[model samples]
Target: MEQSTTIEIKDNSFARQFETIIPEGLLTVEYSFQERKIFLTKINTPDEFQDEIFLDNLIRTILDNAIEQRLKVVPTYPRIVQFFKKNPQYKELLPPGIRI
Candidate 1:
């Protein structure tokens, strides 16, 4: 199995927008606002497994574009942090493992 990961931003909205840009089979992303972290898990089938360099570059490109677009709508870390803090209930949207 091949594996790779990156953390370029710390917001759920950005994470969601990021998902829309990537191919469905290429990756899976988990985001936690409270923890202020994002996890990108690469799901590589036996046939699709490739060199680490290729996967790394692809993920970087996807993340860079996604973050750029999302920032236009919701700019700055402080703004996102404050939004989540004010609406604590939004934390519930996160997966159980990431709720902390």
Candidate 2:
């Protein structure tokens, strides 16, 4: 059987964002209660691990994290937005009235 990947998410209140770390990279995203939106501010991935499937799974993991926290997000990266746009099943991950 294949082992499931483990992605860790840590809330850094000092930075007002969640820090997600996967074997291939790290992503920093900020959540604003007043704005009710999560902002993906930064991403760093090793070139060797930049496969589309890996990236899609990474983004899905992030969105799942946000859902578990009961928050909507505004993905700033064009790639992320495009990915969500292409995948309608993940539409609920977007903030209301906000289209990618």
> Every model's Cα RMSD, please?
12.9, 3.7
lDDT of 2 by residue, 55-88 (tens): 6666777788778888777777777787789777
Candidate 2 residue pairs that clash: none
lDDT per residue as tens, model 1, 26-85 = 333343332433433322223555554544444445445545544211122343334335
Q: Which runs in model 1 stand beyond 4 Å of their true positions?
A: 1-42, 46-48, 71-100
38 Cα displacement, candidate 1 (Å) = 7.4
Worst 10 residues of 1 by lDDT: 71-80
Clash-forming residue pairs, model 1: none
Runs of candidate 2 exceeding 4 Å displacement? 1-6, 10-34
Determine the C-alpha RMSD for candidate 2 after optimal superposition of all C-alphas.
3.7
My TM-score estimates for the predictions, one after another, are 0.29, 0.66
